[model samples]
Target: MNCVKTIVCIAAVMGASANTALAQHTFSMSSEVERVENPLLTNISPGGVTVLRFAPTYAFESRGERYRSRLSLSAVIERTSDTTLLANRDFPSAGYTWGYAWPSSDLELRANLSESATRNTQFADFGRVTVDAREREFLTGARWNKEMTERTRLTLNATNRRVDYDTPLLEDYRELLLSSRVTWDHSETEAYYFEPSHSRLTPLNGGAVSTQTRWLVGTTRALSQEWSLDAFGGQSRVKGAQTETGTLGGVRLNYTGSRLTSGLEWSRDVAPIGAVSRYVRNELLGVRVGYRLTEGTSVAGRYSQSRSTDVATGRGSLFALSLDNQLAARWTSSVGVEERRSSGFGGLSGRGWAVRAGLVYSYASGL
Candidate 1:
């Protein structure tokens, strides 16, 4: 059967097999306005954006399982000194997740799906591409977990994704991933794990097909009452016209306190370029910190950098920063900026920056 049919069947099976006991559902709505300094990440001309956003979410539980879904729609009106360059764009997206737990058998399962329609020029999940394009994407995944012993556990995961673009079809592709992990607890707050994964990629409009496999070992440790660390290293092998091997690894550190929270994340890996039907060497670093000023007020800041290189796409880099605030449980706001620089191949070279600020008002109801 086709992939889309397979996905629908899986969803149907999950819903039919779940218990029918009913539970309350939660619904919420939120709105935000954002301003950006650059609407397109290119060297053409500096632009800005005034963005209006609306989001709604619903959640429910049945028996011992839970399900949730959200939809977000937004309109972005450009703010450029040149009236000819000023235009408006709209985006709509939907996402959902279902989770089930079998405590008696030490098993848990989760499934997720999302669809998006947007004009935003950023990295897409399926491939690398030019910043200016009308894009649509569908992604879905499932995970299974089992606790074998008090000190051991196992997990299995799978995902499928597809992408489409109105411009060039460089980033349009379909992907399937299968992965497994085994964990051993060394102590109450420390554990080690080994993971193996495989991925298959097919270009939508007649490109070469490729498959990749990866293996990794990692450890997670609670360093202190308020701090924790996770690190991993691995290797990946990709089979296309020729076989290529590369290293992959990542590190994440987190801290939580009564009034503060912070994190550092870094990673380097060999993965699909997301724009073209190829693979690349990817590296990223990010840091974030948040502080609470009162019972319902908090502030946070974040920064991140990413670089990617492939034989097909050459190299590119992106940097971003943001500051956020939450007040009185119902009001939230953020300001963010981003820059992109690329020495791309196939006439994809470009550089530019964008900045944005927005506020959200939210309300929730329970049933």
Candidate 2:
């Protein structure tokens, strides 16, 4: 499989580069345990359930004056107490990511390739739960940036992604996206940009292909030393079995302080649902806040709500909070709580809550 091939390739590269003086390697392991009131957030679960998960990762990187390369491999193992729910069974998956960067005085190029597999959670978007489903994805992307002038710059980006499912309930699909942007520095504290992008999604199950095209104008302003704002307005057209045109826009505000960081965002966009092969218009609002209580301890929270503008598509909201503490130089501990609620989407609805605790240990060495 691709996962195995990725592991072998990364191992070979690491062996060949082990003798290099500037190579670095890192390895880390993490374990988490969680208790959920309803594991699947469905009526099928008889009672509360517990889940245990473990992950380990290895990374290698080599850098020079104007170029760099990085490789990473990881695996996940999960087990659950209840066997009734499809998600309750054991899940084992592996993945890898490779990236490269080349930079010069006026131009830069970057590329990345990755493959991963995990349990499908796209059902959560529609207030539904998956039944015996897993998703594997392959992604590749490239970016080019050039300085057109002292105050003007141009960037081009391309990405392709393929998604496959272990179960036939969800159809496999591939997406390709291309985009370009030109940025002008209006002042020391402000910048403006114009962007245009196109995307196509094709399903392997003989479903209608969907395409979207968008044009946008945006600006970024440094409101103050600690505050910044980004706003963009755009128009988008989506075509599939049916064609639709709509206004697309988003706004984001961020604040960075010595001990606190916060952000707020709202956007209207087109997104694809894995359960279905088409695209839907969605409006989303999100807020995140984080505070560093001490040098080694922090607390963060985030909340998001998404609503589909298309009829009967569904709406969902999620809230999560976590506390992280550095227990030692190479060890860390965290505890978190999450709540999710969803409705609509074929008349299915569910609400669930989960509490989790985790610990991580990491080690690094230079070759």
lDDT of 2 by residue, 189-276 (tens): 9999999999999998888999999999999999999999999999999999889999999999999999999999998878776667
Instruction: Give all candidates' CA lDDT scores.
Output: 0.64, 0.75
Model 1 gets an lDDT of: 0.64
TM-score of 2: 0.86
**What TM-score number comes out for model 1?**
0.78
lDDT of 1 by residue, 8-47 (tens): 4554566567655554545555555555453444445466
- In candidate 2, how many clashes are counted? 0
Residue 139 of model 2 has an lDDT of 66
* TM-score of every candidate: 0.78, 0.86
Off by over 4 Å in 2: 3-21, 43-46, 86-120, 123-132
